[model samples]
Target: MGLSALFRRKPHERAGFELYGKAVAAARDPWFFGPLGVPDSLDGRFDLVGLHVALLIRRLRKDPDRRGAALAQAVFDAMFADMDINLREMGVSDLSVGKRVRAMWEAFHGRAQAYEAAIEAGDAAALAAALQRNVWRAEGDATPEARLLAGQAMRVAAALAEQPFAALLRGEARFPVPEVPADAA
Candidate 1:
C-alpha cells in the first residue's frame, strides 16, 4: 500500500463509521429515556450506545466470511474513537483519557457478552436481568422497565436478522421502534 493509502480510510472503514452513526441515533431515541427511564447521564448514554453497537457487532460477526470480521472490527474501532473524542470534549485530561477509554471498552464487551448470550438463548428473563443490571443499575428481580427494554432488544435482534448482510455492509441499519410490553402498558 502507498503512503497516501495509510492516511485514507478504506471503504469498509467508512461504512463502519456510518453504521456507528446510525446506532448512536437509535440509542438517542426518546422512548428509552422517557418511558423506559434510562438515566440521561453520560453513563446512561454510554450504556445505551454500547447496547446498539454490540447488537450490530453481533449481527456482523455472524457472517461466515472475512468481510464480516473486518466490518465488525471497523465498527468497534469507530465506537472507541467516538468515545475518546467524547471524553476529551468532556474535559478529561489527556493522561486519563486512555485509562477511561480502556475501562469503557471493557464495560462494553462485558455487556455485549451478556446481551449476546441471552439473545441467543431466546431467554427474555436472562436478557431482562442483564439489562436491569447494566442499564438500570439494579439488582435482584428485573424491573418493569428492564423487561420492556429486553423485549425491545429481542425485537431489534429479529429485525436486524431479517435485514440483508449486504445492506448492513453498505452502512445502513434499521432498528425497530421501542415498544411497551403489553402487560406494562
Candidate 2:
C-alpha cells in the first residue's frame, strides 16, 4: 500500500501484525534516532545517520512538504552511510573482501572494528566465519518497549509529513558536514 495509507492512521484497534504499526510510528519521530542520528545501540556515526535517514526517506515519501531539520539530517545521514559503506567496501582486502561483504550484508547489524580490520587484512576465513555466525541476532523475541517506540516513531513520522523542502536543505551544509546542529544539547 502507498504511504498515504501508511501514514493514514486507522481507528483504535489492535493490529494483526506484531508491532508493525509501532515500527511505523518510531520511524517518524525526530528524536527516534537519538541526537544527530547517533546510533544508540551500535558503533560509528554513519550507522546512526543511515538509520535516521532511512526513516526520513520514508516520511518524506509520505509527505514531501514536511521536510525539516529531521529530514535534512536523515538525508545527510543516508549520504554518510553510503560513503561509509563505499569506504568500507573499498578498504576490504582482496583475500576476504568477498567474505566481509557477505558478512556485512545486514542493514542494521552491529559489529566491532576488528571485523572491518579483518576484512581489511584479507582474512577470508574470519570474514566468512563472521558472516556465517550471524552474531547480531538476539536470543529471545523483540522487547515490548522496542515495539512501542517503533510505533510511536511511525506516528511521529506520519505527523511530520507536511514539512517544507527548504528546511531539509538549508545552509551550505550538504555532504561531509562538520556539525549538524549549532547546539543540540
Candidate 3:
C-alpha cells in the first residue's frame, strides 16, 4: 500500500465527517445565540453540537437497513475524534485527553438519550426542560427562549425527515434556517 493510503478514510467515514460538519455549522448559527439564548461559551457549543448529533443519529437509526446504523456509528466516532483534536489544540495535556474525552462521551450520551426520548414522545415541555438544563444550565423552570429553542429543534427534525436518505448517505444534510421568535427578539 502507498504511504498516503494509511491516512485515507473509508467512504462511510468520509460521509460521516461531512455530516458532522454540517451539524456543527447548524449548531453554531448566530440565531441560536441571539434569539434562542444558547450560550456562546464552550459548554454551550458542546451542548448544541451534542443535540445536533443526537438528532442525526436518531434519524439514521430509523432506516430499516444496516447502512443507517453503520453511518450513525461512524458519525459518532468522527465527533469524538474531533473532540480529541480540539482538546489537544486547546493545550490540554495528552495525559488528560482520554479522561476528558470519556467525560464528554458520557455527557453526550446522557443528553442524547434525553433529547431522543423527548423528541420521539412529541413532548415539547420535556424537550424544553432538557434543553433548558443543558443549553442554559438553568434550574427550576424552562425559560421562554428554551421553549422556543425546543420548537426550533422540532422544526429541524421535521426538515431532516423531509430529506432523502440517499442525500444523507452521500454526506449532505439541510437544516432550516432558524427564525427569531417575535417575543424572543
A best-first ranking of the candidates according to their lDDT comes to 1, 3, 2
- Candidate 1 matches the true fold with a TM-score of 0.95
Error of 3 at 7 (Å): 4.9
TM-score of each: 0.95, 0.34, 0.93
Candidates sorted on TM-score, descending = 1, 3, 2
For residues 1-185, what per-residue lDDT tens digits would candidate 3 score against the true structure? 99899998765898899999999999999988876667889899999999889989888888776799998988898999999999999999999999999999999999999998999999999999999998888886888888888898898888887788899999999988887766657
Model 2 C-alpha lDDT per residue in residues 19-120, reported as the tens digit of each score? 222233333345535543323453333333333344444444444354343443344344444444665666755666556544443443343232344334
- Give the CA lDDT, 0 to 100, for residue 14 in model 2: 21
Listed per model in order, the count of residue pairs whose N, CA or C atoms clash below 3 Å is 0, 18, 0
Quality of model 3 by C-alpha lDDT: 0.89
Write down the RMSD of all candidates, one decimal each.
1.4, 17.1, 2.0
Highest TM-score against the true fold, candidate:
1
